[model samples]
Target: MSEQPPSDCFICRKHRGEISIPGGAIYADDLVYVGHAQIREGQTIAYLGYLMVEPKRHVPDLAALTDEEARALMILVTRLSRALKATENAERVYLFVIGENVHHVHIHVVARYAGAPKEYWGARVDEWPAAPRGGTQEMEAICARLRVYLQKESG
Candidate 1:
């Protein structure tokens, strides 16, 4: 492996504290940092509960994960999914591990709400309309809720 990950990598910058983490952490440990996804500018359909489970170290992709990281990834993803369902009324959670856009290994855990359009079901859920892409306050309120549920469950 290289002595250090490329400085320009967006995810690496988050790990380096160069960029502030969005939504903060719902649950985190030495292996992972679980937090809400950063809704991009002009983004609408991605709501507050949309989240990411990111590896703390520089694991470039799924193929690069260590044994410990893999186990923690599964546990964190499952816990986050359950928290979303319980607190956010998500009917199902959509999980996708995509590395093409970012070098760091981050798994997206998205909430699929009840009454979501059939056309947007299955592979098309990403196209479904979001409930409300509220501001940081709204999003943080959600993060706080999820954090509470997670703490109880994890404890």
Candidate 2:
């Protein structure tokens, strides 16, 4: 198969500050902050590092990932999963890399609970735990809590 040509990838663009960081999330050198969609308690999205971890790289297919990229992605996945589970009090954690829409490599580290609906199981889930629709005030509060949780965990 022919190798894909290099283009200005979206992730790369965001990483280099060419694009504004997406709202509802924070950007760290090691991770991308994806804000909670459902605004549930202890639910958040922590995008793995840019080395092709959870989300496969450049190409949409998983086969495109190099051995090293795949390994790194797995490591990041495990780390994020454990962190979400502990900090969010999640009964289970879900890792997703389906890029049918956005082809960039990114993972959805969802914090799951006991009563989670069956539809969200496995690879078809995206909704956060039950929570009222929150605005900026709510988002900030959740982000702050997550920051604290992550800090404590790292320490």
Candidate 3:
């Protein structure tokens, strides 16, 4: 069983269904939740195929994950990366676990498309202005495709 999250924790609130995220949940189990990254307020659209893999438990960082949780997290991250490449036609996927902003153990699974400039590689993949982007409708559609792909993959 997981411990209760503090009221101020964003991931906790998100897991509790208090926070709204775009594309909803692509996949989830007892240990991890996979979903598209959220679109911030006032932003017309967000970079498509950007995803977040987060622990269901309210752990602060990687050091806090149990062995089982760690295993589950990494497996899901790897699978999601595969999903992005297959379903999104991504040339590469960038994994980032910077906990500076949210303090939660969330991994950013960013997709890098083919023909992308070297300047937009790594942590700057989302900064590519010409990258595929979408609002809620496109996000929902993309997530649906991903959900179906992952479901079939798991089967």
Candidate 4:
């Protein structure tokens, strides 16, 4: 789509630096951006290592991505997943692209650590009672470690 994202697009606003998300920006390039997910309103703590990877453009879904954009996005996703494994000691990295709520092409790069039960596999990994949960300081620390790992393993 040649048209720009609407003025109210949350992802677009974030790309423009209007919205300050937790951990700030982990990585960014001409086509892709990687950052920790924002804490929902009223939530005191967030699931640690929940990252969002999206294109710089305001594409609505994967189908809207140009070839180059798609390539960059997936490559970064792979790298971020690896970073999670290395930095967070995550046993498994889950990738999700549910666009129903935000209408943005954002991928959820979730970390599933060891000792997580089978019932908590997939999207429910964060629901495990013992899952790693943290506040802003914790989020920032984990993001800092991930940033270093990603930079060292630069693509």
Task: Identify the leading candidate in terms of TM-score.
Answer: 4
List the candidates' TM-scores in order.
0.87, 0.59, 0.92, 0.94
> Candidate 4's residue-wise lDDT over 1-155, tens digit each?
34445578888888889988878889988898888887767878898988999898887889999999989988998988889988899999999999877877899999999999999999888889898999888989988998899888974
Runs of candidate 2 with Cα error greater than 4 angstroms are: 1-8, 22-59, 127-155
Task: Write candidate 3's Cα lDDT for 60-99 as tens digits.
Answer: 8899999999999889888888888888999999989998
Better of 1 and 2 by TM-score: 1
lDDT of 1 by residue, 1-155 (tens): 44345677666676556876556777778888877777775764347578888888886788989999999999989988898899989999989887776778889888888888888876566566654456677778888999999889978
Model 1 residue 76 distance off true place after TM-score fit, in angstroms: 0.5
Worst 10 residues of 3 by lDDT: 1-10
- In TM-score terms, candidate 4 sits at 0.94
Model 1 weakest 10-residue run by lDDT: 1-10
Q: Evaluate model 3: give its lDDT.
A: 0.87
The per-prediction tally of clashing pairs is 0, 1, 0, 0
lDDT against the true structure, per candidate, is 0.78, 0.50, 0.87, 0.88
Query: Candidate 4 — which pairs collide?
Result: none
**Which model scores highest in lDDT?**
4
TM-score of 2: 0.59
